[model samples]
Target: MTPRARLGRLLNDALHRVMAEDDSVFVLGGDVADPQGGTFKITAGLAKAYPSRVFGTPVGGAAVLGVANGLALTGEKAIVEIPSGGSVAQSFDQILTMSSRLVSMYGRTLPIHLVVRCLVGSGQGDGAAHGRSPQRHFLGVPDLHLFELSPVHDPGEQLAAAIGLGRPSVFFEPRSLYGRYPLTPRAEPGVEVTGPFGGSRWMRLVVGAGAGGPSGVAAEVTVFCTGGTVARSVRAARALAATGVTVQLFVPSRLFPFDLEPVTGFVGPGSLVSVVDDGPGPAGWAGAVAAALATRLWGTLRKAPVLLASAASVVPAARELEDRVVISSTDIVRRLVRELETP
Candidate 1:
């Protein structure tokens, strides 16, 4: 039997493996050392493994990022973790004007390898202040590789890819998906999936959301999503399938540097394309994707891509109120159904 582990555990193991293989790689974050590990325990045993390299910082995201910038400038790989989703904004300048721009500012002669890992999303009663999905803040930023981890994908591979970019990156870890794992053998059945991302970082799910392979259906609607909204989006796709709508659901691991080639081949004119995200529209990753699609498929797509995202309001702590702000599976189903049904 294949061993199974929670996504969080996989990420922890990945960090251990990464640090073991690369001596230059070290971690810095608040409460990320022994005992506490991290708010999510992603860096559980790093301090014990590499005492000199791993350091726990004060509860200041900006300070951690600033130090990481200095470390990267010295040609060392630094993984800075922002323990809370809402705290990520505190390091905005360090990420935008400093780490991401250092290489270009220095005449592109040197490369700064830094990874800013943020814990994003609501649902733990942490309230609007601590449960915001701030990926939108860094989306489309030049020289910054933006990635959102999916529970169904391999965390080790995703983390390795982000670190291997040889440039600055913002990796969003969805708090809601820490307990999920990849699909089982039964989920695959007879389905076969092939893609440019090696079929691991992304998936070609079938109806019912039991994905380990692709659905050989001529899709009239194509949905692209990532992060915490993946499972919900899949459920929405499954519901849409029940209504006889062919929905092609693609969950990509990387958000920025989004490869539209795979999308372009599957989606065409007269097809309804939708992007589901936890952030608000027109400024978030969904909006960025929609804009890219519109440009790439100029005059080719009949309808503008739809963005199914969170409401443009502070995420409320109340579960009911949070539902209103965060786009739900039912919301996806309803929105896609309406879009498809409309003349």
Candidate 2:
């Protein structure tokens, strides 16, 4: 892969490959079928390659999802894109009415597979509308599942694997990670990248020792984080390593139907697990993970692990203000040193 490689484009490539292999698979959305190939150019060239199957749509979320719902009803698979996370609020009724019932009613062979894709998270100066990650709204929604694309994992495999399950699902990629996650081979020889979870790995150990290869320093802190924050958490691990406090970085790929295995298995008597979230407050992903981990590991933990997320407030558009709201590597480093490791 070249230095300019991006997860979005690679995902488009995977979509193209899968579409070519399966005639029933089709994709449509605003800017998605354009020569520009999406806001980040992830879907480039697919329209021309599969002109019959890949096409563009109007900006209306309901209208776009409506078309997807139609395609799914007709024994066809559809991958629909909505621009941002908040944009999804408009399609809630459509999703609730249409997504899963159609799939199960129609049976597995003719499964109505739908992949709802959207861009989420804050980059640098994104405003309130564009910056918000809206998955939290669907936290308890029935049948509709939520997943994230981590920069540390392969985008195509994540996309295909989620779609292969033959159900309706929502998968979002963080805006900030598109440019930051390298597309080329690992610059560091010792590092490896794998998709969210293949098996019992649903609660995956993304970086550090469980990431395969030589196990370096033994893990002292079980660090939990999701997409967009994985990079930051990894850096925190590295920084803590320098100061003699080793941390094991854990990234969970799937959000709904929370996986307890790796985290439960990792923690033992006197062990600590830290959940580092990017977005604000004492809730959302961090809260859900903390609750689940605490329930299963209740008897095993030394103390309740610390959860570091954005401050309980609106995320700011200004770079400095935004930085203050979310967790960072420095936040992870200092928190580990003061809260977990230090006597």
Candidate 3:
């Protein structure tokens, strides 16, 4: 099945699980009714099934989140679905000041299950406001959990898991992944098992050296990437392999509080490491990884790490312009080959 189908299945499972377990669990969003089903149709049939629990709110993001905060504080689990990261910016004041800071300020033991679902990435032509990924703004906010999904298949399971987890998670569903596949029914509860928050799972390694060295070409470089960029990295790895260069590709499933131990293990003495991300460069996951590696394995390493990220600019409105700015499979291949050949 396609990823879109998986997402729909996951969402259905999540709604069912939340309703069955907690009466307090409610879904609130802007114009997220049936037929239209918000923007992605993830909420389709939800409001119809659970009329009282699932309903639409005003267009104001702050008001929407504020309502959610009130519900959660009063012992209700509220899931507010924002249309995009741009919409989320309007609610930052409430999220940062009230929703996030309440636990410590009031000394209240409030475990709010708030999920802000938003569309990220390009290709939709949603203009600058709708295309931005403002996750960086919520990176370090306390009392809020950030979860990003990049599924090749089984989107429903992933969505169900995100909903059932019951934390204040900012569930970022890539806009590009929607409609990619059909929704599949989940066999078990989506949130039955909770993986490490802010942790990452190694997807694959792309390198020239398979096992033996000396007879095997020397493993010179490693490239780490995630999200839509993983597929690109894999292609780049194959291209590099053709030239007899060893390139290891590390694709992490989780983004925040990224587990760098596995990544650090891959980088040996004198070996070069590069990180590629679809998000903008400046202060992204790439920068964080580089810092961690430098701090953890400074004295023992032979060369400085190289971080490759999208140019620090907003995603373009035009498809061609966006394509150029976004990291491509060819771009990853070229960078890997060049870095490996250097010195």
TM for candidate 1 is: 0.92
Best by lDDT: 1
| lDDT pick, better of 2 and 3 | 2
lDDT string for model 3 (1-343, tens) is 3333454456555566666676777888887777666777777787777788987877998989899888877767777888886788888888888777655567656566677776676656666788877767777676666666654333444445555554466777667655444312232111111122224655444344553422333456667666556556656766776777666656554456467775565566777777776677768767777777778878765456677776677778888887777777777777766766776
In candidate 2, stretches whose alpha carbon ends up further than 4 angstroms from where it belongs are 1-4, 104-110, 182-185, 188-218, 341-343
User: Mind giving the per-residue lDDT tens digits that candidate 1 earns over 61-156?
Assistant: 788899999999999999988977888889998999898888788766567888888998887777878888888888778888888877556788
All candidates: TM-score: 0.92, 0.87, 0.81
> In model 3, which regions exceed 4 Å deviation?
1-21, 152-167, 181-202, 205-220, 299-302
Candidate 1: misplaced stretches above 4 Å? 1-3, 184-202, 208-215, 298-302
Q: How many Å off is the CA of 35 in candidate 3?
A: 1.8
Give the higher-lDDT candidate: 1 or 2. Answer: 1
lDDT of every predicted structure (CA atoms): 0.79, 0.70, 0.65
Candidate 3 differs from the real structure by a C-alpha RMSD in angstroms, to one decimal, of 5.7
Ranking by lDDT: 1, 2, 3
lDDT, candidate 2, equals 0.70
Candidate 3 structure, TM-score to reference: 0.81
